[model samples]
Target: MSETTHTAATTRASGPGRLLVAVYALFAVAATGRSTVQILTRFEEAPLAYSLSALAAAVYIAATVALARSGHTSRRVALAACTFELVGVVAVGLFTLLVPEAFPDDTVWSLFGIGYGFVPLVLPVLGLLWLGRSHPRTPDAASSAPPSHRG
Candidate 1:
């Protein structure tokens, strides 16, 4: 592949992108554990909430893997995962607030992830911003720029 394409594919996994991937991985483990215990022990207590936690876990896992890989497909997957995570957290937060009775037990996304210090709410935003900022310029765009003189 071309240098620009290679850079675009690999850039997301380097520098600040590494920290983003680490955070995503951490969330994936936390959510997975929480959801697993909730589902195995008291799924009937708050089925919707537990299920949402499971879904959040899956999204986090996907985001972590996608962000750590180098490829066009990985970039797309990461973007989609981050977008879905943002939407899910907001929707779940609102639902739990407006309908308090619907969730006797809190999930990872309840109240915009208040349980996890709001990381769930903020993580996706950060991921999206990082992705946007790290995206590589296309070759045509790069070629149109003035040459640099570093002598």
Candidate 2:
């Protein structure tokens, strides 16, 4: 890998990035467990909500894996996952609000993730910001050029 790509990958999973990855992992587990139980126990109670929870869990899992990896593809995947998550949360949040009767129970994104302390709503924003800030630095021509020698 080029230095720029390597640096981008390493920087993405270091320091605060580690914390972000950990949080994504936590959300993945939580959403997966919640959706599984809801689907198995009482899917009929709130099929849409339960299904949405499952979808959210899948997205979280993808984001966690992508963010934890080190590669250009992983970075793209992370970006897509985070963007999707943000859109999903906003759309679902609005749906639940505009049509309260549409969802018998709450999904992870209900009321902008009120159930999860708004983490779902805020996490993607953070992920996007981190990705933006951690972009690969292009090596300039001067930096790549060989040094001149004085006779």
Candidate 3:
């Protein structure tokens, strides 16, 4: 493989990205555990909230693996994960604020991740920024693409 491809293949799980991946991994585990216990025990209490927690757990797991994975495909997957997370957290956070009665219990995105010190709110932003820096673009993509001169 070419050097550029090698560089492109370098994972976001490197250097500071390693820390990001670690945080993602931690959230994955925590969310999985929380969701599993909640669903297995009292899913009837607040199905929506518990289900959202389960969804968050899945998202976190996907993000963790995507960030840790190599190649452009993984980066794209990570990008999608981050975008979903950003939207989910924002929408859920706002929903909780506007309709407090809707939740009846907290999900990972409740109050902008207040239960998790807002990490859920900030993580996707950071992930997007990291993706911008780490994700590979082909020569035909981005500003690196050849500019056309229209006569």
Summarize candidate 3's per-residue lDDT along 1-151 as a digit string, tens digits. Answer: 5666567557466788999999999999999999999999999988999999999999999999988888667888989999999999999999999999988889999999999999999999999999888766566666776779899
Which wins on TM-score, candidate 2 or candidate 3?
A: 2
Name the Cα RMSD for model 3: 3.7
Query: Which pairs clash in the backbone of model 1?
Result: none
lDDT of candidate 3 at residue 59, scale 0 to 100: 93
Question: lDDT: which candidate is best?
Answer: 2
Please identify which of the two predictions, 2 or 3, would achieve the higher lDDT against the true structure.
2
User: What's the number of clashes in each of the models?
Assistant: 0, 0, 0
Give the Å error, residue 18, model 3. Answer: 0.4
- TM match of model 3 to true structure: 0.88
Off by over 4 Å in 2: 139-151
lDDT per residue for candidate 2 within 1-151, as digits (tens), equals 9888899899999999999999999999999999999999999999999999999999999999999999989999999999999999999999999998999999999989999999999999999999998999787999999999999
**What do the candidate models score in CA lDDT, each in turn?**
0.92, 0.96, 0.89
Q: Candidate 3 at 52: error in angstroms? A: 0.5
The model with the greatest TM-score is 2
